[model samples]
Target: MTAEIVRTIPGAQKRTNDPEGMRKKVLDVAEASFQEKGYHGSSLGDLMAAAGVSGGALHHHFPTKKALGLAVIDERVAEAVAKTWIGPVLAAASARDGVRLVFEAAADELEKQGFVRGCPLNNLAHELSLADPDFRAALARIFRAWREAIAEKVRADQQNGGEKGIDPERFAALVIATYSGAMSMAKTAQEATVLRQCLAALPVSGQPAA
Candidate 1:
């Protein structure tokens, strides 16, 4: 009977009595709002309306706007980074190739979207990193994980007789910084040219010396 109930309403995540479900719904709405409008730009009312929950329901899950924003950063933003960057980078042939593929994919995605909304982690970091200590810490942790993942791949390539003498940590940082700045530029230009140009500039194409 219980399994049938779940099967019938597989999409029923907004059920009022399900606190966990309700929390997830609110977080999803808040994450999108933050990505689209920024932290300060998105009001609690806006989140509630978009989430289709009462003010009390929203408050019960998130007592304040900051709490909601932090949750988005910790959960939604972190998951996105893992999916969009970390996993793909690790799964690629080499760190260099992985980095190139990431840039190419990002450019393609922005083109498909027809407008750049910028990277989610980058967007929130710019708006909230300095606004609060907790925000900075959370964003910094994600950045570290991202960089380390790249560095890990780089080290793997080094072991396999590629990327000789390259400092994995520094190389990883450069890859991240380059893409981040390029994305910011792309957002401003409302096009993917900067992203493509940045990708071209990266030394991700050559083979290591024997």
Candidate 2:
């Protein structure tokens, strides 16, 4: 069909030469699929359909399913962790306050959604870590970055005379562990109560004013 004829066809899309736009569109669909159904569970044909891309277009950006999965982890999941956890902690008055606020916000968001899908990173880690070495490394890096961001916040809070006598790195790990477990429990229960309970029992202490 001619270009003009293609444009006039109902329900037909006009192809663009915008590679970056296409890549981002695929990434958005792939990330959501990976988060909802898992990497192993989201098949390529289904992904292509959901992404509104042909096999050639999908492979042009990601040569394999593993490549797509890695991109989702390195790009999409990392961005989410940065926005949801890291940014809030760094901007909060103290590490304790930062973590508390994150928990509260997460609980509220999950309740509103009404279905607990669990943490994207946590969900992917459990499913992919044991299945592939590259996947493990990609996921490990995100977890490390997340842990370090929290640890850095804790260190800053301590220097300001809060979170006294606590090991920043260890405390950071504890915070992640608590959230991971709470999210898992909440996913199973299909509720956010475990998250609220865990948040209430968070160990780190902050300034009274905070």
The local distance difference test score of each candidate is: 0.89, 0.89
**Candidate 2 lDDT for residue 66:** 88
Cα lDDT of model 1 by residue, 173-206, tens digit: 8889999999999989999989988787777856
Off by over 4 Å in 2: 1-20, 204-210
* For every candidate, C-alpha RMSD to the true structure in Å: 5.3, 7.2
Model 1, residue 28: displacement in angstroms?
Answer: 1.3
Model 2, residue pairs in steric clash: none
Off by over 4 Å in 1: 1-20, 206-210
Backbone clash count for every predicted candidate, in the order shown: 0, 0
lDDT of 2 by residue, 103-208 (tens): 9999999999999999999999999999999999999999999999999988888787877888999989989999999999999999999998887777743332
Q: Lowest summed-lDDT stretch of 10 residues in model 1?
A: 1-10
TM-scores, one per candidate:
0.88, 0.88
